[model samples]
Target: MLLKGKTVMVTGGSSGIGQAIAIGAAREGADVAFSYWGSDEGALKTKEAILETGQKALAISGDVALPESAISFVQETVEVLGKVDVFVSNAGICPFHSFLDMPAEIFERTMRVNLHGAYYMVQAAANQMVAQKTGGSIIAISSISALVGGEYQTHYTPTKAGLLSLMQSTAIALGKHNIRCNAILPGTIETEINRDDLADASKRSYMEARTPLGRLGKPEDLVGPAVFLASDMSQYVTGASLLVDGGMFVNLQ
Candidate 1:
């Protein structure tokens, strides 16, 4: 039990990679609390799975796009599950839109949810950790898009890239408090956000061929990496971006 007697809070944990991370933490003996935007059904399912592991679970419904909501969520987590030992800022949105067709409203909304929301969550978590005087870990779920540009992700990729910079800054600012911050850059994982894109045979084949592993990554593929960052195994690691992209980032061809 890498996280025995710990408490973990995850955002956007109702489904996909976030869901997997929440469940994985619970299995490692960490009580889990997660936030969901609007999916009661999905949130309930994730809560049930975490409870099945014999770890307490709290499912909070709120919009991370609002700073107040993010602050409130963290406060609620502390009130229920005690101090958060690990905070995963995984709530984000990636909408495909060609640069020429992108609307200003859409772009702003993306930044609000992906970058600003993460900022609030990280700030709140760090404050709580400092208050408790217990060092903690903060994991930001970024993406390969942050490394390389995407044709339809001009608006989306920047937010992901911003996360890396945010983590670095937080790592430096919070190190004295013993709080570590890192980013997890996942490859083209098969998730609800990218399901339609991956379903296209041509795009799917292109992605698989480009990836050295010859397959698109699954949500489960990220569980181990996330757990490593959250646990004491990575006590000395901070301000780093761990890529879990199945070698796609290195395949130049």
Candidate 2:
């Protein structure tokens, strides 16, 4: 009951890490809402799960990459939930290609969603948190790619790296207002997005062998840290990143 009576929003909540964070919040006794740009079916399923946990849920449909969409989502969620106690900017895309040969559009689109979208969400949510004067938490789902450069992942790496800096800057500015901002850099979480990309045998084996944990990360593995960041458990913590990469960053081989 760490988050009892609190309200939270998770973008990309239909699946993957976003879905996991939303469910985790509900289980911790928080009212939840989440945004999904894709399938309504997945969003509906997540909604049902949230309801079963006895938490209210608002399944919003929108693209986080668009400023208007991000603003609209924040406005609508506040209308329904009264106030947002936590916001997790989890929506992103990673389509890898050689840096020299990558298409301009793909790179631009990735920057739009992964970096710009997060900026807007933080602005929207932070504004609300300031108005409420109740303080809140903001967690951005970053990646290990930001820390370690990898071949063919140039676009993704910079955006994820931007998230870490964004978290630090926001945490400093919002500290006096009692709003906390942090990033969770997870390594190789077992999500459909990654699954699709790992169809190549070489990529699959590389990630597995590189991770010291001897296994790929699960979406559920992020639950504890998400809850911690969203709850008072991290009240004294801000301007930091909790790297949940199972030693991926330290394996330097």
Candidate 3:
């Protein structure tokens, strides 16, 4: 019950790390609200899992890239689940494209979804947290690529990098209000988006060779860190990027 009586909003909680984090939050005794960009199938499944932990759940559908949508999500979540004590900005996209071959539209879309969307969500959530006069936590799901350069991921990397800065600055600005902001930078997590490709032997080998742990990460691997951040265990933590990459960055040669 690390988060007992807390209300948490998780964006893109349909699958992957987002889903795991949502479930983890529920298990920690927090009422949870999660947003999905696509169908409710995945979100509903996650909601079911969360309810099994005996927490109230809300699986909402909306596009995070739209500022209005982000604002509405916050308002709706607050109305349904009460005040948000933790906000997890997990909505992001990574459409791989070579720098030279990438289209302008691709870059714009990535920035819209990955960077701008999270910014707006934070803004909306911060307003609520401040008004409630209760200390809260804001967690951003970034990527290790933000710290290291990656091939064919220029757009994705830059946006993740922006998240780090956003978290840092927000933490500073909100510290007096007892609101903490932080980011988690993951490396090569196995999710639906890359599951098929990672299953291939050659691709698997490439990822294993780079990670010092000798394997790609599972989506659930991010849950523990997320729960710690959301709980009183990390009350003194803020404006930090916890790289849960199994030493992938360190092993890079």
Q: Highest lDDT: which candidate?
A: 1
Error of 1 at 83 (Å): 1.0
lDDT of 3 by residue, 88-172 (tens): 9999888777898899999999999999999999999998999999989999999998898978789889999999999999999
Which of candidates 1 and 3 is the stronger one according to TM-score? Answer: 1
Assess the local accuracy of residue 117 in candidate 3 as a C-alpha lDDT between 0 and 100: 96
List, residue by residue over 70-152, the lDDT tens digit for candidate 1.
78998999899878899999998888888997999989999999999999999998999999998999999999888999888
Q: Report lDDT (Cα) of residue 98, candidate 3.
A: 89
TM-score of each: 0.99, 0.97, 0.97
In lDDT terms, how accurate is model 3?
Answer: 0.92
RMSD in Å for all candidates: 0.7, 1.1, 1.1
**After superposing candidate 3, which stretches have Cα over 4 Å from the reference?**
none
Candidates 1 and 3: which is better by lDDT? 1
lDDT computed for candidate 1: 0.93
Q: Which residue pairs in candidate 1 collide?
A: none
Colliding pairs, model 2: none
